[model samples]
Target: MSALARTAARLLLGSAMVGAGVLHLTTQRQEFRAQVPEWFPVDEDLTVLSSGVAEIALGAAFVALPGRKRLIGGLLAAFFVVIFPGNVAQYLESTDAFGLDSDRKRLVRLFFQPLLVLWALYGGGWLRRHPTG
Candidate 1:
């Protein structure tokens, strides 16, 4: 994709992350709590809150620090990977949240995680052999 497209993607993803982070800390906090795995030792509320903060920081950095896009994008992708197990637990444990009420919905949701990773990488110009700003 062109640099313009990559930039657009990066901006959109950053905006989305910011929005999601806000949700995690605000109205959707309870809903986000459902994503925390029972096996995970951290308090659900704390996890949600911390992740929310992380999302906001990373997203803001991704958008405001173009010079560090590559690093920020990688971190964002790692964040997605890190949260993936929670998604899996939700599916396997039949825990429902965020409208993923059914097994099929939860299962299908898992497939999108990789796309998020790819989006981060591509938007950060990792996919380009010669990335152009």
Candidate 2:
């Protein structure tokens, strides 16, 4: 991909992370709490707050560190991977957030996780920009 496109993608993702992070800490706190897995043994509010902070940091990194995008992208992808179980828990428990109210909706959402991972990789230019011997 062209540098311009890659930068645009990164900016978009960064903006989303920042927005979601703010939501997690503010208006959507209760909703995010609902997405926490029950068996995790952590306080829901704490989990939401901590994840919100992480999101903000990650988002800022994506926007501020273009030169280190490969590393930032890898970390962001890992973050997505790490939170995937919460998505699964939401589906399995029939917990609704972000309007994923039905089994079909939640199931469909599961597929999007991989897309997020791919997006992070592609936006960071990790997929095709570098050549390995």
Give the TM-score of each candidate. Answer: 0.96, 0.94
Question: Can you give the lDDT of residue 84 in candidate 2?
Answer: 99
Candidate 2 has a TM-score of 0.94
Q: Which ten residues in a row have the lowest lDDT in candidate 1?
A: 123-132
Model 2: worst 10 consecutive residues (lDDT sum): 123-132
Question: Which structure among the candidates has the greatest lDDT?
Answer: 1
lDDT by residue (tens digit), candidate 2, 1-133: 7888989999999889989999999999999999999997899999999999999999889999998899999999999999999999999999988899999999999999999999899888888756578
lDDT of 1 by residue, 45-87 (tens): 9999999999999999989998999999999999999999999
Best by TM-score: 1
